[model samples]
Target: MSHSIAIIGASGYTGAELIRLLATHPSFEIKALAANSKAGQPLANVFPHLRHLDLPDLVTWEKIDYSQIDLCFCALPHKTSQEVISKLPKSVKIVDLSADFRLRDPAEYEKWYGNAHSAVEMQSEAVYGLTEFYRDEISQARLVAGTGCNAATGQYALRPLVAAGVIDLDEIILDLQCGVSGAGRSLKENLLHAELSEGTNAYAVGSTHRHLGEFDQEFSAIAGRDVKIQFTPHLGPFNRGILATAYVRGDSDAVLAALQSAYEDEPFVEVLPKGETPSTHHVRGSNYCHIGVVQDRLPGRVIVVAALDNLTKGSSGQALQNANLMLGAPETAGLTLAPCFP
Candidate 1:
C-alpha cells in the first residue's frame, strides 16, 4: 500500500529533508517535486547531495497532477502557503509546513503573521501537527499544520508539566538557540558566513517571537488559562538543530516524572535521566527529540532542556509522521531512523 507523494517548494531546506527521509520510506513514493523557481531543472541543480537519487525534475505546483498524488507536503513560506494551499485540490491530503494553519484562530494568525488568513476555511479544518499530543486528531484530519521548530522544542519540554499542574505557568521562561537553517534556505544579509558564523545573538526578544503565539495557544489550552511564557530566541552559528531550555518553578522530581510519563511510549521522543542535559549535536539530522530535566541551585526551580533537528522533527519530519497516520500506516513507519550523532 505505497502512498504516492508530491513535495511543493522542493528546493528549500525542509523540502530537501522531506525528500531525504522519504527516499527510504517503505510506504511512500515521491511522484512529483515542485519548486517554481527551479522548474524544469533537475533536483541535482538545487541540491547536489540529492543527485544520486532518481527523482523527478522540479516543476511548478500548478503543473502537478494532484489526481495521482496520495498526499502533498506544502513546504512554502507563510503568506504564500495559505494562498497555494487554498488552491490545492481538496481530494489531496495536505501536510502544510507553514505557520498559516498552525493557529486555529484566524485573528491570532493575523496577529502574529501580520495578515488575515486567506484560507480560513482550510485553516478551520487543519489539525495542529504536533504528533505526540494530537495523534488521534491528525489521523482523522485531511489537513495538518506543522509547528515552528522553536515552538516544538519548547513544548516538548513544558507541555507535560503544564498539563499535570506541576509548574507555575506565569513564571515560565523559554530561551532557545536554533541553527541558521531554521531560518530557511532563503538569502538574507544576517545569515551570511561573515555575519553569522563567529557570533551568536538573540532576536525576537521580550516575548515578541512569533512562536510565542503557539506557546500561548497550546499552553493556555492545556492549563485552561492564559499561559504566557517569556520566550527569547537566539540564532546560533551552526546549521541544523534547536536547543530550548525552559525555566520553571516546579518540583524537579515531579517535572521529570511528568515528562517521562508523557513520552515514555513515544518512539521519537527520548526523555533522559535526571540531571542529564541534551545537546543539538546528539539529535541532528533525525526525527528524534532528546529532553533532559535538572534541579536548579535554588529549590523548587527546575531547568528542562530539549534538542532536535529543526528541519526534521521540527517541520518536514513532523509532516511525514502525521501523513503516515492520515494514510493509515504505522506512525513510525518511515521515521525510525536513529539520530545522527557526532
Candidate 2:
C-alpha cells in the first residue's frame, strides 16, 4: 500500500515543490496539505502552475489528522518548524526542510538563529539530511534535518576533500551565486523585480550567512576539528539554482579523484569531466548536483564548482530523498526527473 503523506506549510516554494514531486510518486499519496496563511483556498489558486494535479486543499495545521499520515514533510519556516515538529506524533516520520534541527548543538543553533531551540530534545535526534553522506542514519531516523541549499551545494563540492585530508582546511573559500527564489515567497523590497532584475550583488558577505553553522558542524565532524570556510552568497537575477565555486589549497586532480570516489555510487551527484565546469542550467529543476574541478594557475590552488537547483537538490528534493530512506522506499524514487534545460 502507498504511504499516506501530509505536507505542513504547503503554500511555500519548497512545499509546492514537494507536492509537485509527490503528485506522481508511485508509492506515496498526498493526503493532507497545511498552509495556515492560505488555508481553505484551493492549492491551485495559490500556485496556478500546479493546477493540473489533483491535490488536497490547504488547511491550518490544527485541522489535519496527523494519525493517518505515514510521513510528513515539514516545510515551515525555521523557528516555526521546531515548534510544529515538537508536537508531531512519534509514529509519523518527518523530513524537515528548515534550519531548525540541522544543528546538533542547541547552543550552536541559538548562536546562528538568534533564538533558543524550543525543541532541544528533538534537535539532538535529527539526522543531518545530506542523503549521500547520511544514508544509514536517515534510513533509521524519524526526523531528518535537511541542509541549507547553499550549504548543500558547497558540501557537494568539498566534503570528500575534507574527509580525505586532501585539502588545507584553513584556507577554504566558497563563492556562491543563488537565484532570488532562495529568499522564499516572502515580500522584500530587494526582491522586487525592479530592484533585483538589473544587477547581481553579494549578500551575507564576511562569513555572516547562517549556513556557515552547517559548514562548521559537518566539516568539523569529518575533519576531527573545527572547520570554517569563507562563504559569500550572491543573489542572481534568475529564479532557481545555486552555483558554488570553492577555492581551496589542494592538487586539483587529487581533489577531483576524492569527489569521484565519494559519489561514484550516488545517483544524484554527478562529477563532470576534469577541466569542464558545470552550469546552473544543467541541473535546473532537478535533484542533481553537478561538480567540476580545475587547477588554478597559482601553485597549490584548486577550484571546484558545484551546481544544483536550490529548490530541488537543495531543499524539497532533498527532503523527499530522505523521506524515501526513512520509509523504505527506493532512495531515488520520484527523484529521477531529468533537469529542465532551455
Q: Could you report the Cα RMSD, in angstroms, for every candidate shown?
A: 0.7, 0.7
Q: What would the per-residue lDDT of candidate 2 be over residues 83-166, giving only the tens digit for each residue?
A: 999998888899999999999999999999999999999998999999999999999999999999999999999999999999
- lDDT by residue (278-318, candidate 1, tens digit) is 99999888899999999999999999999999999999899
Q: Which run of 10 residues does model 1 get worst, by summed lDDT?
A: 333-342
The deviation in Å at residue 242 for candidate 2 is 0.3
Clashing residue pairs found in predicted model 1: none
Global CA lDDT of candidate 2, please? 0.94
